[model samples]
Target: MGKMLTVTTMFLIQMIITFETSGLYAMAPILSNNFGINHSSIILVNIGFALAGICAPFFGVASEKYGKKKFIIIGVSTFLIGSIITSYANGATLFLVGRSIIGLGYYNLSGLLLAYLGDIVAYSNRGKIYGIIRAASGIGILLSPLTSTYLISNFSLKVYYLIIAFITAIILLLSFFIPKVEKRSSYKISTVDIILIFRNRDGRLFLFLNFSMGTFLVLYFSYIAVHLEAFFNLSALNIGKVLTYSAFGTLSGIFIAGILSDRIGKLKLTKIYYLILIASIFLINIVNIHFIWIITFIMSLSFDGGWTIIQTISSEIIPEERGVFMSLVFFVVSLSLILFYIIGPVVYSYGGFLYTTVLSGFFIIISYILFLKFAKNNTEKFN
Candidate 1:
């Protein structure tokens, strides 16, 4: 009975994260146009979210000391408030602040959702369960673009954000329904422990892979809409269609990678995921054919699918430190994402579309080689 309730709560939390992120992404281009800004500035929507993720370690420690249930409820409520503020934002600064607050809420969801899963499930079945939770996230990704695009076309951005705010409110309400979860163990969070986490060879390797893959995802997602607008001369409505298709591809990858990881082992599957992702980015750069959405969908499948695998693998790297390690995983990923925000637009400015895309691919190749070299032989330590 206890286990069943835990699974249900985790699944609901996954849904909340998925819906919030999808709505934000769907609103990205609209926010850009309304604010009179470049795509780079628009990319900061994600940056805000990533920045929130950067703070996950601090929050994780707080969760341990204060209580996971308390932090989660507070995070969800705060997110709802931020969503309301974002709906009314008039300038970039106001919009960004609001978005950053939303990011804080999302970090709680995204950073802790899987760790929570890890806490409740057995190690042998962890990969498959993680995959299921992430795949569930794709449901939000699938719907948000479609819904946001429709709202923007017919109603107003204010209305769209209002709906999101309401959804966030619902999430907070649902959070209350979660039975109190007692901490099984605790740790004193200190500066030195934080340093040890980063300096350890195994820990550093996991952090690097987490951040690098995160950067790669942000670069493509942040730019793809703008790329379509500039290159294909597509409207926001049309671009949403392409994004929706891409979301479907991501779903396919999420489920397949999750199943594969259960059978083949994360270490072995990771190499394949890395290579395929590198190739996919190159494919995005070189492909010039007119079937716009097709190419976009394929790229989404490859990149997001690959990302799902990396995420699952990283979760298993330091199981004893699930809260701390997950926090670091999210934090480093968020930091790299901020770097990508700057890197993507600056590189796109000089190199244009194709060159910028190819550059991101090169980064993946470098990181892939490094992870392969540093990864341990057995999963015993992680367990």
Candidate 2:
């Protein structure tokens, strides 16, 4: 019962974190109006979050040395505070400060949580567990836009932040009840440990793959809402409704991939997922406004599917260093966001959405090739 409570509490944390992350995208336009900022400035929220995540590797190492619970507590508390600050921010500087804090807290909490799971769960069942956890997290992404839209439409956007802050506080309290796990090792992280990660072929490939996927997904998500409003003239509520399809797709993909990968193999499923991902992005360029939801759904499904598989693979590669490995993966992902926010708008302005979409797909194509060449036969061994 205690174990179950821990998992349930973590699941709720995942949901709230995911919701807060996705909610920023949904609130972009409203934020722009509220703070009187431009597109670039609005994207700073994402950039700020990514910048903070640069500390993930360090946080991961610290968690291994100190323990996961302390970091989880710090993460939850920091996120709650950040959300409160963001909810009441009246200027761009304050908003960015709040976002940066949220980013820092998010990376610490999430990285440690994955490490915690790696310590407790067996490798054989990791795929299915990841699927379940991600599926739960997907609910947040699924509901974020709709909930944000409703809140913004009926009440005010600030209400969304307050609600997340309140729930996160509750989750923090529940976190104290998580049963402690034995630390895997007492060895402190060093330069050798960091270097060894890249020395492994699988680790290097996975990091690069994560970087590519992060770039592709961020580019798509960072612009999709704005694109809908600009190209299709959709209202905020309608945009939220359309975005909901992506969430549905994400949920379906992660749940199905989770189960199937355990049977058919995570690598094999990833190959198919990449193909679908590529096709979906290309289709988005040509699809009519009415069909946007379907394309976006396919995109979300394929993206989430591939993401889950890779994460499972990362956990298996260096089971002993699972925390650091996951942290590195996310570190690259965060870097991608920083890079994209800086460059994505320029690409969109110069070449339009078609070019930007194609560019995003192109990165995935490279990732697919890398996966086939290196990870095709890489399968997890059960301990």
Candidate 3:
């Protein structure tokens, strides 16, 4: 019962954090208006978060040496503080600062939670368990936009932030309920340990694949809200409705992929998802406005599904070092966000959504080829 409570509490914490993160993207239009910034400038909020994520690998190592629960508590508390600041911010600089703080907490909690789960769950069932947990987190993504849109339209953007902060505070209390796990005996986690991760062929492949895949996924979500508003002339509520449909697809994909990953193996499933992802991106580019929701749904499914598989593969690669490995995975993801934020606006300005989508598809194709050439053999070794 205690174990179940611990798992449930952790899942809820993840769900709330996911909600907060997705809400920022969902409310991008309103935020731009509220702060008098352009869409391109607003993206810096996400970049700030990514910049803070540079600490994830180090935090991962710290979690192992010190303890996971302490870091989890610290993370949630930091996120709460950030949420409070963001809620009250009247200027762009303050908002970005708050977001950066949230980023620090976000990566810490997300990375350590996976490592903690890896400690408790058996290797055989880890994939399915990750899927379940990710699906739970996906609920936040599923509903955040819809809820944010409704709240922002009816009330104010500040209300959304306050609500998030309040809920996060509640979760902080629940986090204390988390059961303690046995810590590693060695308190020494040197730079060499992290460097050694890259020495493995699988590690290199996973980093490259995660970065490439993340480039597509992050760019799509970060700019899609703006695209719909600018290109299709959709209202904020309407855009949120569209994203809601995509969120459903994300949830379905994570759940299904989780089950399939355990059965078909992560590598094989990833390849299939990659093809679907390419098709979905291409279809979205050409599809009429009315049919875009369907295509976006497919795109979200493929992108997020493939991401779940790859994350599972990453965790399994160095099971003993799951914290550091997952943190590095997130680090690469953050790096991709940083790169895309710099270039995404330029791409959108020059070529618009079609060209941007094509560029993302190009990245995915390269990632698929890399997977086939390097990761296939090493990935199969574990599966």
Could you say which candidate leads in lDDT?
Answer: 3
lDDT of 2 at 266: 75
Global Cα lDDT for candidate 1: 0.73
Model 3: how far is 35 from its true place, Å? 1.9
Off by over 4 Å in 2: 379-383
Q: How many pairs collide in each candidate, listed in order?
A: 0, 0, 0
| Candidate 3 similarity to native, TM-score | 0.96
Determine which window of 10 residues in candidate 1 has minimal summed lDDT: 374-383
lDDT of 2 at 172: 92
Minimum summed lDDT over a 10-residue window in model 2 is located at 374-383
Candidate 3 structure quality by residue, lDDT tens digits, 246-316: 89988988988888887887778888898999898888877889898999898888888988878777787
Candidates by TM-score, descending order: 2, 3, 1
- Tens-digit lDDT track of model 1 for 26-56: 5667778877878666776556766777788
Q: lDDT of all the models against the reference?
A: 0.73, 0.83, 0.84
